[model samples]
Structure formats: structure tokens, C-alpha cells
Target: MSAATLRAAIAAPAPAWGLSAAQIGRAATLALHDELALAPKPGLVSFVDSGSHDDMDAHTFMRSLFSLRRYFVRMAELGAAQVPFAELERSGIAAEARMLAATGGINTHRGAIFVLGLLCAATGAAQALDGRRDADAVREHLRRHWGGALDARSQRAPTLPGGIAARRHGLRSASQEAALGFPVLFETALPAWDDARRRGLSAQQVRLDCFFSILAVLDDSNLAHRGGLEGLHFARRAARAFIEQGGAGQPGAPAAAWSLHRDFVARHLSPGGCADLLAAACFLRRVAREP
Candidate 1:
């Protein structure tokens, strides 16, 4: 689909699932806000501070989210109509352009735009199929509908910094991760989120635990891009150690996370891929909770 066609689609009347699309879009934006508000996210930007990043901060993220609001709604509409993956990709490209424009060329939510956009599309498609908005249904629809295209996309040579780093280090790129249906998001982060809630942890603690769980396991090409193999290994080890010590549920967990945050800042390492997954997980959680 051409960019002009996508723009016209956006300006067109709402689809059958228009209300649901709007809700899905709001959920995605709120999930990003949830991520941004959470503090001491090691090597990530938040309301508390711009951990390890000097170029962008909470305000920049807010702007990116604002720019992406309509994009998510449009993606949902496209998915409900069962448009081709190319359409979704075009929407994402347009959203990324808007995000860059909003952030003044800073890449605040590029990864989120791709990751959460797919999830939103999947959710819309799933709802249109049977009114089932659960995570399993959404994921199944995503893979069933667009998995082949994603795999093909993963095979293409990448020019982005994170993709280049992944290729150089022999790690999975974001495209590769999405091609596999986002195993870290569906398997690791989502389960960790549920487990934390089952353990009666606070909302913040659940997010923290889920975030660390993703950091522990994901190849995190962003971390590799920023800190190399050594930096990535250090981050995985630190996250593992945090989980071993009872995660965010344990005593003094916040203090421990703060200490790790400082260490990550000192090393200039940012697990941006993990952060995006965390936000995706948050979106799934929100959608699942809705009737």
C-alpha cells in the first residue's frame, strides 16, 4: 500500500470496529505512559530520570505517544478489515515518521511503534473474528495472519543501528523476534507479569519484575548496540541476579533496582528492546482486563 492510500484510509470513516479500535489505541498509548511513569527502569527513560539517555526523556516519549495515537487506531482498523501486512508496515512507517517529527528527530518510540502497533492490529483482528481479545487469541491471530511476512522481513538486510548490532553479534533482531511471534513478550514477559500478580505484588513491582525478566532473557539488540556483547551480558546477569533475589517483591527491591539503574547509567547501557516488550506486555495486560 502506498503512503497516500494509508493516509486516505486514516481520514476515511470509522470501520465496523471503530470503537474497539479507539479503545485499543488508547490502551497502547496508556501502556506507553505506564512504562514512562514507572521509575528506576534500569537504563531506560522514565518520569524519574532519563536513565542512560541524554538525547530523549519523559517529555519526548509523551510527544511520540501523542503522535502515534491515531496511528494505532488506524492500524486496528486495517487489521479488522484484514488488510495485508504491507498495509500494516506502511502504517508503522508513517507512524515512525510522525514520531520522529514529534521528537525532533530523536527516536523515542520507534520500537514501540512497531511492537505495539502489531499487537494492536492483532487485537483488532482477533476481536473482529470472534470478540475474543485475550492475549492468546491476539498472538495466534498475529502469527496466523502476518507471521510469514514478518519472517520475510526478518530475512532482509537491516540498516538500523539495532539491526546492525544484532547481525554483528549474531543475535536476534527486532524483526526476527516479531517473526517468531514475539516469544519473549508472550512467553517471558507476559508470564512474568501474571506470576508477579499471582504473588500479590504491587502494580509497580509486577511491571518491574516483568521488565527484568525480559531483560534477563531477550537478546536485546539495543543493549548490544549501545554496550556491545559485554554490556549485554552484564545486563542479563544483573537482571538474573535481581530475579534470583526475589525480584521487585523482595525487601529493598526498589533500592536494589536503583543501584542497578545507576550501574547501567555508568555503563551507558540501555535495554531498549526489553523496554519495548515491557510496554507491549502492559498493553496486552490492559486489553485482557477489558470486557
Candidate 2:
């Protein structure tokens, strides 16, 4: 879809989904904030530092988030109306433009805009269908409604840096992951988060553990783009070692994570894909808990 078409869609009257759209949008925004506030996230931006990215910071992220707030709300409205995938794709493209403008052309939350945007849309669609807002329902609705589109999108030629890196290295691109209903977010990250919470870890620890769990397995294109396949494998190994040592439940776990963060920064390796999935997991968890 063209930018002009997206503007036309924005100008049109949006269907009312009551407070549901607003609520889902807020959840998506908060989920990004949740990811941002997490400190010592290896090779990712946090409130304390810019991680591997010297070009952007927490302030940049906040600006991007502010610009995207309404985008997510509109996505929810579209999902509730069961608009076609092309409409949602255009909305996301528009949101990405707003984010880049907000950050002076920096790409802070493009992945979040794509991942969380879809989840927010799915959440709205699920609610509209049967008032089901659980993670499973959201995933099911996303696949049922948009899975074909995502799968088709996955076959397109590489454009973004991440997609280019994925193709170059034979790694699964984000679109492929999405078409598979985000198996890493749904199967891996969320389960790791649940286990951490079940073990009575602190909120920060739970998130940190979940982050590491995702880094351990995700074929993060950001890592591949920055540090090549070697760097990606090194990051996965480091993350697996962290988990093998009892994760965030062990003493000095925070310190360990900090140490890994330093190493990742030194290596200039950023697991941005993992970070996006972590935010998605956080969004799902929040949505599930919302009344």
C-alpha cells in the first residue's frame, strides 16, 4: 500500500471497539516500556545505557514510543474490524515512518512496531471474536486471520537490514518467525518467563532470565548483521551458560548478566530479535492479566 493510501485510511472513521482498542494499545506501549526499563539487557538499550547501540538511547526510544501510541490504537481498531493484512501492513509502515521521524531517522522500535503491533491487533481481534484475550487465543487468532499473509510476506526478497542478514546467513527472518506464530515468543520466551516467576524470582530477574532464554536460542539477525555468525553463536553460548548456571535465581546472577552485557558491548553484538520477542512476551503476559 502507498503512503497516500495509508493517510486516507487514517483520515477515515475508525470503528469503535469501546475501551478495548485503547486498552490493547496501552498494553503494547507499556510492553515496550517494560523492555526499555530492564537494566543490564545484554546488547540492547535500557534506561541505564544504550547497550550496543551508540546511535540511540532511552530518550530516543521514548520519542519513538510516543509517536507509535496512536498507531497501535489504530491497529487494534483495524483488527477488531477484521481488515485485510495489507491494511495492517500499511498501518505498520506508517507507524515506522512516524518512529523514524520522531527519532531523527533512528530505528528504535521498528521491530516492536511490527511484533507488538500484530499482537495488539490479534488481541483486539480475539476480543471481538469471543472475548478471548489469553495468549493462546491471540496466537490462534493471529494465525487464523493473518498467517497466510505473513507466510507470503516471508517469501519476499530481503529489504530490511535484518532480513538481508537473515538471507545472507540462512537464518529465519522475522517474517518467517511471525508466520510460524512466533514460536520463540510463544514457546520459548513466555515459558521461560513463567518458570522464572514460578520460581519466585523478582520481576527484574524474571525478565532478565527470559531475555537470556531468548538470546540462547533465537537466530537474531541483528547479531548476525553486527558480529556475523560467529558473534551470534558466541552470544547463544553465553546465554545458554547463564541459564545452565541457574538463571536469575542464583546468587550474583545480576552481576553475571552485567558481565555478559559488557562482553556483548565489547563485541558489538545485539540480539534485537530476542529483545523484540521479550517485549512481545511481556505484552501477552500483561494482556492476559488485564481485567
Candidate 3:
């Protein structure tokens, strides 16, 4: 063998544990892809349907994904550097601007940029330390390290639509979810995903189950914002009924879900908060798969 070939053979193996910034970013991107690919999601844009959105489609989401990939990596790097919450938010703001520009000023993945960005940072911080990449470890680190700052952010006066709607409707805002270290993402959505997997559900079926489960409980401000209190309640009831019927795993569940999707479109309702939680669940599932 040549000298170079011999050196290549003797190179040290990469660590089996801990994710680098690039890995974290890639995982986040893949999670976004997974969310976008899940079809027949009620009132949410997917590869196969626009679902109550006229400004965007699967292509728009793809562009946003391309724009935000490096942002997730940068956030992960910042986490490894132990930056403050303000710094993270600043980075996220810049990333959101890029996303908007890429999608021609239409809001696509705005919620994901916020929630998933923090998750990327938290994952980096967890893995950067003793390589403890578990979901509980990352969540604990997030709450222990930045919980105060997040709670403070939640107290700020409402500016965005989701926040305004949440305040008016007395529902928990996305900022509050971040402040509370995303209890629904970790405690609710992730477990539901795992349960669906264990029960031998298909990929699409698992995502549908997870989405309906989140919708049943989440006071989705987007639904309130678009459809009012009556619309929100109606959405929750519909989701609860679907989940009660064994979600997409039961016979005829997919057809029922499609019917509900059409109803949501007809009513101009969107469970955007539940969609964000689903993205977070996908991200956490990727992180959990490392071990």
C-alpha cells in the first residue's frame, strides 16, 4: 500500500456517542422534511396538499428548509459555546428573515424555526457536555439553564398573531411552551410517537395519531385566530373523536381524516400549534434514535 493508503487505514475512529453541530442540523432538516411529507394532515400544508394555505406549498417549504439548514447548525454551535437566550433569539430572528425571504414573505415554518431552533441548541448543549443526548437530559438542561429567560420572554406584550390570539383566548402561547421547556413536545408528542411505533403503525399513521393527539389537548391559537372560539372547540372535538377511533391505524381512519381535512379547509381553520409540536416530536425522535 502507498503511504497515504496506510495512514488512512490507521486513522482514528469517530466517537460512537454525541452529535456534532452538523449532525444536529441535518437531523433538524430531516425532521422538517418528515413533517412536510406526511400527507392528509388537517389544514396544514404538505407535499400532496396545500391545506388551507394559498401562499405556500411543498415547494415553498422546501425553499424554507434550504434557507434554514445552516441556521440550525449555527444554533447548535452557539449552544456548544454556551450562549445566552438573547443570543439564541437574535440568531433565530435572522433565520426567520431568511425563511420569509425564501418563501417570498409568506410564513412557512415560522413556528418550526422557533421551536426546532431551540431544540437544536438544547440538543447541542446536551451532546457537547458528557455526550448525554437523551431527550430528558436535553430538556432538563434547557429548563435548568435557560428557563428563566424563556419565562421572561413569555411575559412580553403580544405582537405576533399567534401570541395575540393566545392572549385574547386565554390559551397557552408558543412562547409559554418554550418557557415551560416544551412539556407537550417531550411529555406528550414524543411518547405518542413511540407508542404508535410500538403498536406497528405505518409512518403516516404514526404521524396522524401524533397530530390528532396533540390537537385534542393543545389550545391551538391558530385555530382560535382563524376560526374563533367555536372553531377551536370544534377542532378539538373532531381530533378527539379521530384519536378515539384508533387514529389512522383503524380501518377507514384515513378516509375519516381526509374528510376532516376538507372540513378544516372549508372553515379556513389551521391547527398550526399542533403542527409545530409535530415537528418537535420528529426532532426529538431523531435525537432519541442516536442510542
TM-score, per-candidate, Cα-based: 0.94, 0.94, 0.93
Name the TM-score of candidate 3.
Answer: 0.93
Q: What overall lDDT, based on C-alpha atoms, would model 2 receive against the true structure?
A: 0.89
- Residue by residue across 219-290, what tens digits does model 2's lDDT show? 899999999999999999999999999998888998999999999999998889988998999889988887
The deviation in Å at residue 83 for candidate 2 is 0.8
- Please identify model 1 stretches exceeding 4 Å from their true place: 1-19
Note the clash tally of each candidate: 0, 0, 0
Q: Mind giving the per-residue lDDT tens digits that candidate 3 earns over 35-127?
A: 888878899999889999987899999999999999998887776655778888999999999999998998888899988898888887777
| Deviation of model 1 at 154, angstroms | 0.3
Q: Is candidate 2 or candidate 3 better by lDDT?
A: 2
Clashing pairs in 1: none
Superposed Cα deviation of residue 126, candidate 3 (Å): 0.5
Per-residue lDDT of model 1, residues 195-284, tens digit only? 999999999999999999999999999999999999999999999999999999999999999999999999999989988999999999
Report how far residue 155 has shifted in candidate 1, in Å.
Answer: 0.2
Where in model 3 is the C-alpha error above 4 Å?
A: 1-16
